[model samples]
Target: MLGALNMGAFFALVYVAAQLLRTSVAATIMAVSPVAMMLIAWPLLAERPKPLPLAGAGLGLVGVVLLVASGSGGVNPLGVAASAAAMGLSAFGHVLTKRWGATAHVLSVTSWQLVAGGLVLLVAAVLVEGAPPRVGLPAVLGFGYVSVVATALAFSVWFTGLRHLDAGTVGLLGLLNPVTGVLLGTAVAGEVLTGRQLVGLALVLAGVLLGQPALTRRWAARRAARVAEVSPGSADHPGSSTVDSRVPVE
Candidate 1:
């Protein structure tokens, strides 16, 4: 619940700040979330990646660099400050989620966060945004899509996976968001993807593929088998335990 609420708060903060400034600047700031997640994961989650995920993160960094570089224009001080705050807050929340682990109930956490965030947005709409002007058809449609499909549906799929997976693996999957967003935005919004951006995207995808926990797990098993074969009775030894050490204790 803390994780979800923190993410929601971060999003809400960014969205509100965007409204108060330029959309591009706010987006750039939000892009920092992935990088922040990786940094936090290293210390807080003790995420020791073996080449692949780190490479993927590095690739993703290229994409992010391209994103920021491509958007270099009139800088708004207020926008910069707000975006930094949003990024920092979201990153901290991500670390907290990893620290808490997947034992936490996903639905309850998501729901509480949504409810809390929605309430916060409601208050902001009323007080800060000054009643939030009456929505036209387009705005109504946008809001509906954001609330229903983007927020509800995306989170449902994400939370389901999170419950069954390591936080680091889940975090790696986030690399997809930027890639998909860049490609889809280019296609749907008629934005052009430059050659540099394409290269960056490829690197980012490579990193994601490399860092997949499934691959690492498979490799680890293979290594363990080799070790057991070499050591003979190592697994049957009294002190040197297997991966199921927790089972006998529990």
Candidate 2:
């Protein structure tokens, strides 16, 4: 089921949607996945959403909307449906993996999931597309890169993150996908970054920072220290204070 949702259905649907929709439209739609994952993780994993992180996610989502809105193409209902389904399935699968695979080795789990999904996709491909088409060296190289770096290595680290972090935080980190894509386009393809995109980029970075566990822990620690200073005593014994009885007698 994990394999089907994350690897097979998610990838298949994304490919279909990408073919039908403009790049910006498809990417913007995909950017909402962190929110979806947060919602799914709430009920499934009992990871209650934190207000600051949730707000950050929302801010990042709005930033993504602004970032991609400039280049959005005409909407196709089928394409929209496929993109939404891809997002939903991936989010669901991610939460499920976190809940069920808590004790499993990350790489082992990833390997099995990929293998299972690959087999299912292979069978489907044979039936639907008849046979694999011959590819040139560049195409083969691209496939190798995606298979090794993108699928295998990427998923290994992703599962490791799921093990160590709250699902919401991990999901929020996914916002980097679109951010990286836009930056890469600008740097590699010579695409110009507009002012709105620049603002959006800042927001996305801020959101990701807000959702980090280290930042949250620091914020919590500071708040706790301030409360301690204000109260100056334990809640159970409000006015009581501790003193060293071993001091020299006055």
Candidate 3:
């Protein structure tokens, strides 16, 4: 089931949507997956969504919307539906993986999921598209890169992250997908970055930074220090020496 949701169905639906929708549009739709994952993880993994990360996710989502709004074309209903399903399934699968709690090695778990999903995708392809078409050397190389670098290596790191990070934090990091896409278009495709896109990029970066565990912890610590300083019996308080202790001291 994990394999089906994350690997097979998610990839299949994404391909289907990509055929009918613009890349920016599809990517923007997929950007909501982090929020979905956070919600799913709340109940399934008993991981409560922290306020800072939730706020950052909201900010990042807004940034993604701005990044795509200019380039998004007319929406195809089927494509939109497919994209939404892919997002939901992937989020569910990710949260489920987290819920399972890293019982096995990350590589071992990733490999098994890939193999199971690959088999299902292979059978489906044979049925729907008949025999595989012959491809040039370039195409074979591209496939090799995707299989090795994109799927195998990428998923290994992703699962490792899930084991160590809060689901909400991991989800917020996924906002980078669309950010990378937009930046790649500017750099690789020679597309000009508009002012709105620049602002969106900044917001997305800010959001990612805010959701980082270290930053969140620092902010929490600062807030706690402030509270302690203002409290009557705190050491930093001027009147603290006047306050009597409730418990007997040695």
Candidate 4:
């Protein structure tokens, strides 16, 4: 139920923004979805977080800021509003995905949401745009790629993974999107990544990677304890340490 509304809102907003905002601005604004998810999770879910996730959230925000500042173009009030709506709703959807990760059937849940969203988008296209404009071959191909590869194949793997993972873990995987976007922009679209953009990207990557509990700080703790136990002090003492390094420090 929640996924339907959230995913539906995202498709609608993305469609509206593509029409309303410059491509650069639209691209940048899209980065907000992940950050918004983390923020929403902080408030709504009973999930614990680590430094990296927090950092990723901060970096994601920086990316948005840079993207906004890079454009001196007059702000379209509609675009801004639509973008905000998209992120906020997306956050809610992610939280729900996480909440139902173990129990719900990811494929079924996603399928139903896509069906509902597709209908809404179809209706919206008809009402506002009066049918899609005559798309060129390039645009047609692009749409085909989006629908076939991005939507169908991508989500198939995504939802399957969701069924076996926590929300944060799933969210962390999404960090790849922005980085991939930047790379694709550079290679395919000939857009350059500026110094600020690079920094922002680094920060965003760091945050997302750091955010997951799976990549917990326990590693360093375990290593340190192992070193301590094996040090001359412990080895000099009889029966000082029998615990495996994997065990948490009491």
Index of the highest-lDDT prediction:
2
Cα lDDT tens digits, model 3, 108-148, are 88988899889889999999999999999999999999999
| Overall lDDT per candidate, in order of appearance | 0.66, 0.87, 0.86, 0.68
* Candidate 4 C-alpha lDDT tens digits along 48-155: 554556566667656555533454768798998887777667768767766665566766766767788788777877887796778799999999999778986787
Q: Estimate each model's TM-score.
A: 0.71, 0.87, 0.88, 0.70
Ranking by lDDT: 2, 3, 4, 1
Q: What C-alpha lDDT does candidate 2 achieve relative to the native structure?
A: 0.87
90 in model 3: Cα distance from truth in Å?
A: 0.6
Clashes of 1: 2
User: Per-candidate RMSD vs. true structure?
Assistant: 8.2, 4.1, 3.8, 7.0
The C-alpha local distance difference test score for the whole of candidate 4 amounts to 0.68
C-alpha RMSD (angstroms) for model 3: 3.8
Q: Alpha-carbon error at 118 in model 4, in Å?
A: 1.2
